[model samples]
Target: MRRNRLLSAVVAVCATSALGFTVPQTAAADPGSTACSQMPSDLRPTLILGDTGPAVRQAQCLSNMWGGEPPKLVLDGIYGTVMLKKIEWIQVCHGIPQSGVIEDHTWEVLYHPALDCYLPYPD
Candidate 1:
């Protein structure tokens, strides 16, 4: 239970810290297990809400491994809002803008989730 709380706080802090926008603390959710490890590693398409196909699924694979747990997703390759939020959360954690769009910076973080960077990177 404590781990969940900590991850929730991390999510909120990352999101709110991104671009100085304060996201509600309630935005956090609990999930586990990421199939992303098995998904293609080279897929870095800039996905947004409404897009679909293997690219979107690849994005989903990456996002399912952050914070407290992997977000519950269908992996149907549809870039829905849920996945969008997850991607944005990942961006926020990496001090990237929460535009909900995957860019090069996002890919950098996705490619190297452990790549330490300046905390609270300027938006």
Candidate 2:
């Protein structure tokens, strides 16, 4: 009877331990995992180096969403050398031409960024 009681206690402890433990789940650490809707501009213009205004700010904000971290481009509504390089890297991530220009395809990427990029951020 004592052996049966000990076995029952052991089984109860095991079950309780199992119930207490929680399995770790895969984390969605990428910033672009969320939808891009709060943009400065709804106009999808063809932005290039030396561009400025609301559309440029929108592009800058969207570009910030890539690379799983803070955007290198300031939301100052101006597209300069930094924005150019970042845009090129973004283009590379999407397997597109690194044209440093925000056209239709680039706009698509800016709106819906990848969860992660195979390439590392450029210097």
Candidate 3:
């Protein structure tokens, strides 16, 4: 039993490490200043191009941590075309489908973004 547990732990560590999971320190949000703080906390909703609310603003802020090459997204409460493109890029970075939709999986990536995205940012 102990040996099994050890093997499981080792596999877990290796899986995470091998996936190149690194969050950029420079773009990380300060604890008290995260965009999620802009509104009262709630469950993240499925957002698309026309949605407008705190959740979209929260997503926009979290998405900014992916680095500034394509430029940071404005923390506006509205979701629009620019935000859609960014979301698509972020999906591609995570090897997810480029759906341009903020659902559970996309929200997961936004909350825990990787530091390096090899693909070029969309124009």
Top lDDT model: 3
- TM values, all candidates: 0.56, 0.65, 0.70
- RMSD, each candidate, Å? 11.9, 12.8, 8.0
Clashing pairs in 1: none
Question: Compared with the true structure, what per-residue lDDT tens digits does model 1 show for residues 29-108?
Answer: 11122335444565566767899887776656555534354355677888887777667767777678889887778765
Candidate 1 ranges with C-alpha deviation above 4 Å: 1-40, 67-70, 114-123
* lDDT order of candidates, top first: 3, 2, 1
Q: Is candidate 1 or candidate 2 better by lDDT?
A: 2
- Candidate 2 accuracy as lDDT: 0.73
- Descending-TM-score candidate ranking: 3, 2, 1
Local distance difference test values of all predictions, in order: 0.62, 0.73, 0.78
What TM-score number comes out for model 3?
0.70
